[model samples]
Target: MATLVLAACGTDAAAPADRDDVGARVFAANCATCHGPDLGGTDRGPPLLHEYYLPDHHPDVVFATAIANGVQAHHWDFGPMPAIGGLSDDEVAAVVAHVRDEQRRAGLME
Candidate 1:
């Protein structure tokens, strides 16, 4: 018997890569629904752009974990952040970057 090898499909089959744009889109899609378009917090979500949270402390990691596993971590004190398992790691990276950038611009970075 002879073996059969299958070649991979065209690159078009893969999803487009746009970390920054995707991050913004993702935030607008999933987060903005609760966090607001400016990330200024909403009636449901807590403020993530001010002194309430410190980005330098471990924001990127914390944000990633919270998104991946839901906000059952210590953030419940503020409000329950629903889990967004639909967001990929890269999307999370973009959100974190956007938050960091905003924090820096606001002089809230520690």
Candidate 2:
């Protein structure tokens, strides 16, 4: 039974994710708790779907840094945000991509 299970699992542990799903997957797992399921604001966190977050204003680096180093509550009333240290730079990038895509879709880019 163990051999059958292992055989079904295959040898490649690092299977690639579908290109379109990367950002959302990362976001759902890591950022969704605070940022909300639809990237909208929650009681604990501000909305990423707002115009204030456009890359021209907040920039991608800001997102990366905020996730890595945490954020202070200067813009919203959510209070200070703490650093999320478990996510890697790549995962952070993926999360950022997902957020930017969401931001665009929300018409926040305008």
Best by TM-score: 2
Candidate models: Cα lDDT each: 0.61, 0.71
What root-mean-square deviation over C-alphas does model 1 reach? 9.8
Listed in order, each prediction's TM-score against the native is 0.70, 0.77
Clashes of each: 0, 0
Global lDDT of model 2? 0.71
Query: Mind giving the per-residue lDDT tens digits that candidate 2 earns over 1-110?
Result: 22322232243243324322765787888778888999897888988988778888887777877887888988899998888777655566666767877776777764
Return the lDDT, model 1, position 53.
64
Where model 1 places Cα greater than 4 Å from the true spot, the runs are 1-18, 73-78
> Clashing residue pairs, candidate 2?
none
lDDT of 1: 0.61
